[model samples]
Target chain A: MCAQKRAKSDVGEGSPARADLDRTRAVLEGPEIGRALTRIAHEVLERTKGGEGVTLLGIPTRGVPLARRLAERIERVEDRSVPWGSLDITMYRDDLRLAPARALGRTDIPAEGIDDRVVVLVDDVLFSGRTVRAALDALNDLGRPRAVQLATLVDRGHRQLPIRADYVGKNLPTSLRESVTVLLDEFDSRDAVLVGPAKARPAPEEEH
Target chain B: MRHLLSAGDLSRDEAILVLDTAKELAQVSGRSVKKYPTLRGRTVVNLFYEDSTRTRTSFELAAKRLSADVINFSAKGSSVSKGESLKDTALTLQAMGADGVVIRHSASGAAHRLAGWVDGAVLNAGDGTHEHPTQALLDVFTMRERLGHLEGLRVAIVGDILHSRVARSNVLLLHTLGAEVTLVAPPTLLPVSVHTWPCAVSYELDEVLPKSDVVMMLRVQAERMKDAFFPTAREYSRRYGLDRERFARMQRDAIVMHPGPMVRGMEISAEVADSPRSTVTEQVTNGLSVRMAVLYLLLGGSESGIGNQEGQA
Candidate 1:
C-alpha cells in the first residue's frame, strides 16, 4: 500500500494508474483492529512481567500511531505511562539505492533511553521483514537494549528474512500479487485492513 | 538535485527540502553511533585544487558519516602539480568508480566543468569567485535554527562582495528562501553587476544593522586584491568593519555571522565574534549537517530518480 504511493511518484505522470478501491476487501475493520491491539498490549504486559523495563518504539509512517495506541492501552490497564517513540529506518534500508533517496522521518527516542531495556518494535504490517531488518540496524546505533522483540498489527506472511513477530494481531496468509494495507484514523480517514490487487509493480521487498 | 553546482540552481521548495533533510540528519550526529549505512558501498572523492580547512574536512566527515568510502585528493601533493590537466584528473576519478565528487577549485565554474566530465555527482565546495553553495546552505540552516524561519527575515551581507563567493551564494539562496537580503559594502568592493542581483545594496553597515535580523560579515580577501579595493586596513575597519559599536546597533535578537577563517580586527571585532550573537562556531557544525543532506540527496538514490523523490512529505 505504501509502496504504491512511492512508485506512483517515482514514475511521475506516466505511472500506472492506482488500483481500483472498489475491488478491494476489508479484512479487519476498526473494532477488530482495536481488539487486536488491546490483546497485543496485554500479551506484551504478560511477556515483560507487567510491562517493567519495556519501551515501545514504532517504525515510522503507520507504525508510530500504532505504538502510541498500544502505549495508551498499556497505560490504562497499569495506571502508569509507558515510554514510546518513533524510529525511522530510512537510513538503514538495503534497497535505498534501488529507489530514490527517501526523506528522513523523525527518530524520537524517549528521555529514559533504550539502554538495557526491553524494546518492542511495533509496525503496521510485516511482509518481507526487510523493514524490520532495517529497524534493527537503526536500533543498534541508538543504544544497546537488553533484548529486542517485534510486534505488528498484521502479519501477512511472505517472510524474506528469518524473522518472526513476537506479538501479532492477525496471522494473514496472502498471495504475492495481493497488497495488504493497514489504514488508521490518525493518517487516513478510516481504520481498517484492506486486501487488494497489487498496485504498480509489486515491491515484495517493501515490508511497510 | 544531481549536483549542487550553485545556490541559484535551487528553487524555494528544493532549498527548503535540503534544510528539512538536514534537520533530520542532525539527529544522527547526537547518537552514540554517529553513522548511517545509507551509502555503505558508495564512493565519494574529495578533490581539492585550492587550499581549505573547514570545507574540505566538513565534506569528508559528511561522506564518512553516511558510510561512503571517501578518497581525499588535494592538488598540492598530487599529480596536478606535475602539469596534469583537470580533464585527466577527472578521468582518473571516473576510472575509480566515484559515485560523488566534491570539488574545491581555484577556477570559477570548476564544479560545473567537472560535472560534464564525470558520471558521478559534482558538489561545488567553492569555486574561485562563483559560489560556495554548501557554505550558503549551512548559513541558511544556522539562521533557520536560531531565528525559527527564513521568510521575510532581513539579512545584511557586509564586506568584500566582489571577491566573496560566499556573498554571491548567500544572496542567491537567501533570496530564494524568501529572506530580504541587503548587501552592505564599499563602492569599490561591490560587484559591478550587484544592481542586477535579487537584493538591495547598501553603502553603510551602520545604516543597515538596526534593520537587520542577520548580519553576515564576509572575509576581506586581501590575497585576491591586485589593486586597492579600499584604503588602508585601519580606514576600511573604521568604515565597514563590524566592531562592538556597530554590533550594538543591531536588533536585540539579531545575529552576527562570519564564514570562518575570520580576520579578527579587519571585518568583525573579536568581542562580537565571541559574543552569544556570533554563530561562527555553529556554522561549522551546521556545515556537516548541510553537506550530509546534499550528499544523501545526491548519492543516496539512483541517477535517474534524483528530482522525483526528494520532495516527499
Candidate 2:
C-alpha cells in the first residue's frame, strides 16, 4: 500500500507536506475500518466452518497489525484465539534487483505452525498482486498449508496476477494514476483510507 | 557498501545496519526450508588463495543459503598453483560474470587488488594480516547478542596482536561501535603502531580483566611465526594465557571469545574455552549470518544493474 511506501520515504525527510494530500479523498474512516474488520472476521468463520484449523499470516509493515486485529475480532466472537504471525516476503520478491536492497522485516510463525492449516494471508491493499505472489513463494519455504486465501482491507482494481481477495474490507475502483493509502493507528496514528493522485510520478505498478 | 574490504570502511550507521540485517537473516537458518530466493541466478565465487576450513566453508554456505550459485576455487590444484597471475584469474572470473567474489589470500591487499580487476564485489575473508571484516562482524554480533549492546562496553583483547587480522579488524570495528578496547599482550607481540590505533594497550592481562566486559583471546599464529616472539610457548601461556585464575578475575558476566583454530593451551585454557562464557562456537554460527548479510547488501542492490545501464548509455 502507499502508506508503507510513504512511511519509508518519511524516514530520511521529516514528514514533508505533500501537495497530493490536499486533492485526496478519504474513502474509509476509523469506525468504518473497525466495522469492516468485524464483518470479515464473521465471514472467515462462516467460510472455514467456525474458523477451525485457521492461521492468520500478515504480510509485514501494515499487514501485521491488520492480521492481529482480525485475530482479536475472531476471538471476541468464537471465545477462542486463532493463531497469527507475520510473514515477510522481501526475500521472495521478483523485483529485488530493480531497486536497492531493502531492510528485511520480521517473520514470526506461531507455535502451532501452518502445516495442514488454512492460512489467510492478510494485507492492507490489493494492488498489482505481485506482493501476494511473493507471499505465496515465501509461504512455500515456511510450511505446507492445506489452503491459502487472500485478505485485504481495500481491494483496488487492476490486479496483474490472477489473484483476488477472499475477504475484502472495501471494493474501491480507481484509475491507475491514483494511489491508495491505508493508514492504521498502530503505525500512522490514525485509521483512514485515502485515494489521491500519485505522490511522485504515476506508478504503473504500485509496490505493496 | 560495495565491497567488504576493511572494518574501518563501515560507518557507525552502516555497521549497525549490517548487524540488524544479519539478525533477520539468522532466522532463515531455523526455518523448515533454510534457503531464501533473494540471490537466485546470481553467482558468488569463493576464490581462496590460502588454506582455510571455517572461513571458506562459511562463505560458501552463506552464499548457498541465499540461493546463489557458488563456485569454490581454491589454490590447491587450481590454475594459481600453475603460476596463473592474479590479474588473469580475476579477468577470467570477470568474463564468467561473477556477481560477487569472496577471497582469502596469503598476501595483504589481495582483495583490494582483485576489486580493481573485477566487476564483481570483493569480500575479504582474511587477507594476510590486514583485516577480516566479516570475522570482526561476527565477533561483534556474538558480543551484542550476549551483552545486549556495544556502546560503552569494555573489551580487552589478549594475546598476539601483531600477526592477527582478527585483532586488527576487531579493534577498528569495536572502537567505531563506541566500545572501549584494551589490547593486552607482551610488548614484543604488540605492533609498533599500537598507539596509533583507537584503543589502549596493556601489558598485564590480570589488571584489565576485572574492568572488562569482554575478553577476546587471539590465536598465536605458530605457522606465521618464523622467529621466537616469546621465550617459550609455555612461558607465554603462563604469563598471558586465560587460565582459571585470570578467568575468575573477569567480571561475572564477561564473555570469552576466540576466532577459531585456537591455540587452546597457549592462548586460552581448555576449561575456559569449554565454559558457558565462551562464545567460540556461537561465533562460527554468527559468521554464517554475517556473511549472508554482507552478500545480500552487496548483491541485492541495483548498483550492478545500473552500472550495466550506464555502459549502454
Candidate 3:
C-alpha cells in the first residue's frame, strides 16, 4: 500500500498530487465501465461455458479494473467466483531499460496456482508480445495453467512480434507508420481510440 | 476504418482534410441535436492503458455525437487489477464486438500492438511521450480559429519539450501548415536533433516572446524530476513558467495555450490561464470537433468536402 501510494497519488479532489496527473478531467461524472464489463463477462461465459473453472488474472492498473468487472459478471452469471488475482510484471519486462525505472505496480498471486486452470491474461493493449511473455514467465513462476488466452479492444496491425489476439472488439489494420490509441472514461473521462499519423519523437538528447 | 496512427501515414493533403472535416463536425456540436446518424449501429470502445481525461473525453464525445455506441475500458480497476495480459484483455473486447477503439498507453507503441490484434479501426490518443495528434489538431484549430490561417504564423511551444507528445505532434502539424515553430525549453528539455524538424529552437522563452504570434505552454511533469530532468522545479518555474511577469512580456495580442488540467502554480499562472488571451477552454471545445472530424474522415467520408490543401475549406 505504501509503495502504491508512492507511485500513484492518493485519490481525492484538488489534491496537490493532481499535478502528477498529466490531464485534468471530469472523470467520475463522465460514463460507465460496468456495462462494458457486463458485456465482456457475457462473452467470457459463452466461451468458457458457465465459468465453472475459469481464472482471470488482470494486469496491474487498468487490466485489474477490467478483470474485476468480468469477475463480477462471471459471478453474476454462474453464481460462482472463479479465482481472481492482480499481477504486476514490471520486474519481468524485457525493455525496462528503455525508459525510466518505474515504481512497481504490484503482484497478488491467487491462492490457487494456475496449474491446470484455464488462465486468461488481461492487459489494455496487445503490443510487442513482450508483456504477455513477461506475464507468461511470471505465471510460470506461479504455477502451470491449462490454457492461456488473450483479449483486447483494438487491433492496430503492424506486429514486430508474432503474437496475435484471440478476441478483439475491433480490428484496425494500419501501417507501421501509424498508431492507434485507446482512452477510457475511468483513467480518461472519454472513451474512444484515436488514429493518427505517427511522428517520430526524437530522444531528448537529439533535439536541435 | 483504419487506425489514426501517425502523421507519417498522411500526406500534407490528408492532414488538412482532417482539419477541414473537423470544421464541419464543429457545426454538429452546436446543433439542438448533437447526435449524428453517421456512425449509427457502430460500437466505439475506449481502451486506455494510460491515465488521461481530456483526450479520452474528446474521443468519447466525438463517438457519441456520431451516434456510435460507446464503451469505456480503463486499465485501473478490473482485469488489469488482477494482472490479465494486454493480449487477453484485447481479445475479450474483440469477442464483445467493438467496432472502433481509441487507445492511450504509457508505452510509446502500445497502441501499435492493439492495432495489430483487433479487427476494428484504431485511433492513437497518445502512447508514452510520443504523440498526441488530436491535442495538436485542436490546438491548431484554436489557433486557426483566432488567427484566420496557419501559414507563416510564428508559433512558440514552450516548456518541457523533452517529454511532450503534444510538442512532437504540434511541431509536425504546425510545420506542415507552413507555421514557423520555435521550440523553447531548457537544453535538458529538448530532443537531440531538432533541426531535422521544420522549426527553430531556443533556450530562452523571453528572447523569442516578442516575435511569436502564438505561445503554447506544455505541462512540466514533476515526475521527471525523479530523473534529474532539471535542477529544480523552482528553477524550471523561474525559467519557463508563464507567470504574470513573463506572460506580460509576450506580444500583447498573442494567445497563451495549454492542454490542461494546469498545475496552478507550476508551468502557467492562474492569471494567464484564466486570461481572455488564453485559448485553453477553446482548445477543449475544439478537441471534440477535431476528434469528430477524425472519426468522420477516417471512418470513410470524402476528404475533399472537409478541408482544402491548407484549411481553406
Worst 10 residues of 2 chain B by lDDT: B304-313
lDDT of 2 by residue, B261-281 (tens): 887788898999999999999
Candidate 2 regions off by >4 Å?
A1-18, A201-203, B304-313
**Per-residue alpha-carbon lDDT of model 1 for B141-170, expressed as tens digits?**
999999999999999999999999999999
Assign candidate 2 its CAPRI class: medium
Deviation in Å, model 3, residue B149 alpha carbon: 0.5
Instruction: Please tell me what DockQ candidate 3 reaches.
Output: 0.01
RMSD of 1: 3.6
Provide C-alpha RMSD values for all models, in order: 3.6, 3.2, 23.7
* All candidates: interface RMSD: 2.5, 3.5, 21.2
Per-residue lDDT of model 2, residues A19-106, tens digit only: 6568878899999999999999999999999999999999877889999999999999998799999998878877667667766777
Model 3 per-residue lDDT tens digits across residues B1-313:
3566654455566666666656655755433345655566678899987777888877998898877889988999879879998888888888988877788887787767777788766778988888777788888889988888889999999988888888988998888888899999999888887778778999987898889999998888655445777787888888888999988888888999998878877889898899999998999999998887777555433221222122111
